[model samples]
Target: MSHSAIRRVPASVQSLRSRAVWLLLALVLAVAADAPSAASQAQAPATADDLKQVQQMIDKGHTDEALKRLDELAVTQPVVPGVHRLQGQAYYAANRFSDADSAFAAALVQDPHDLESTQMRGLTLFRMGKPAEAIPLLTAAHNWGPQTRVDPSYVLALCYLDTRRYDDARHSFALQYGFPPDSASSYLLAARMLFRRDFVPVAKDFAEKALALDPQLPLVHQLLGEIALAGNHLDEAIAEFEKERARNPLDGAVYDRLGDAYSRAGNYQPALESLQRAVLLEPYNSAPYILLGKVLLRQQVPANAAMYLEHAVGMDPGNYMAHSLLGQAYRSLGRTSDASRETQTAEKLQADTEPKLQNVK
Candidate 1:
């Protein structure tokens, strides 16, 4: 395929199909926060134009500029909770945790009964690695949320995960997953969480349930494959992923996962082929490239590995795994300078995104 050629495939069609399957399984998918919260203060009774302007700024990722306008509005109209709420949302989207918490607090100060702001504040604290502090806030929100058009259960589940309350997390998943079990993304999260908590038996059981509900789910087989691999059943895992590929021939994500399974089985040649296909299908995504590069490097194909590794770094500048793999590729190719640079970049990009140690199957 030509590099510039545009594939006719929709970006997330398989994912969409998976959602349909989830409905059949009685799993509910939570859909909230298409956009972050924003404060609603405007000096002059809040015109539509001001809202449009703020939205435009947000779309452009000009958060600071948007906040400046919101700040001006708040000074003259401190009574509006919407302004403070939106400000908190904007800060959260920018990953400014402290600023988001303060904005939400200010909104709550204006109206103690603002459930939206309270839930958002709890979420901000959770994201900031302070789930212990978030527990009470989220509990309060959950208790009063339905009355105020909020689902406290969503926040509650995350809080439970942070506090290592496995039973609570399981209950939360049972409730929400019942709403949307077949959804690939939802099941993936449940499987990951369950596996992290060392609930191996349940994780496998849930993976099987999710697969039965949605055979073509993008990531469902992958989780099953991982579970099997962890149990030393490499051939079973590979066969499972192969079955998934047969069910959805055009799914690049499935191919990448199958490739991982093949690698674990020590089938380097097939692993290289599957991962290469995945890279071709989703060139803009860094994961397949990284995996393909690893497979090639394992086979001692240094030049081929370097090309894929370079592409991975180009696609995701902040992906530490990509940089680390690229560094290894460079070293294999005897490029000392490139290797050193890549290693440095990987180190600089390393930050904790994974919440905690949970034994994901």
Candidate 2:
């Protein structure tokens, strides 16, 4: 974190407005109220109490005032210990990553062995999209063995993935979750982890490795089918899903996926058969009933579609898609008022859930 390396990170406050932020603020207060560490004790006794008060202000969502007090304290005691680290924590809480980096760097200069500073600096660099710079510090922090509940291993894995170091990511993830580094489950875990980040080709390769290691592995074929379906390779998806059905005959989700592929390929007859089987296999699941209703609507059987959709809506009142599709069915059946009511309900639900859906953090 040299002067030249301290660039402002483009972070959005809205993206990080979850309960995690609240917990972190609370953590600041909790840690500051604890007995002072060696760093805090190196300063005058008054300075230590003052720093604790600053942390209280930050915990109460007063970064601006907390920072002002820290500046005053630094002016009074030019060589005060742990001041820079407290400043970094305040900046981080305020979403000021560039300032946080500089403060954390200064703390490290005074005490290079500060594990908390190392971890915070690594996280700040990561938020600035400097994963290459963050890796060494995070690796060091990882070796410190859970100093706090917040694990740096997950961020390290993301760094490895972002840099396309698939092998490193696999090892890191295995270490994080206590899996054997070369085990089949580790490869599968890595594959799904990559898939979640939209690295589909690498995910497919790892999934292939998982399958090779254990031919009887469950969900491997289903994962393959999902990748194929995402790419609109309907024939491949259907084939892979059929193989998964063979491996997991009692899995209703496989039948539902199979029905979705058939419907996408305009094979409504096969779609109806698969969906019916899914419904029978999962009698209480609203998902199969919804898919069945969709297939029926596509087949121009509005009465049957409405019946299944009504049952699905009854089971999951908050499902916007079911409400929307039920609205369409009602419209087809000339039930104008019922269609209008369902449409309004669906729109309201969609609007209410949009913020949650867009919350990447």
Candidate 1's C-alpha runs over 4 A off are 1-112, 120-153, 163-189, 192-202, 212-218, 229-233, 317-361
TM-score of 1: 0.54
| Number of the top-ranking candidate, with TM-score as the measure | 2
> Candidate 1 on 230-273: residue-level lDDT in tens?
78798988887787777678888878888887887789989888
Predictions in order: lDDT: 0.75, 0.88
Clashing pairs in 2: none
Local accuracy of candidate 2 as per-residue lDDT tens digits, 290-352? 988898998899999999999999999999999999999999999999999999999999998
For model 1, what is the C-alpha lDDT against the true structure? Answer: 0.75
Which 10-residue window of candidate 1 scores lowest in summed lDDT? 33-42
- Please give the lDDT score at residue 89 for candidate 2: 85
The deviation in Å at residue 127 for candidate 2 is 2.0
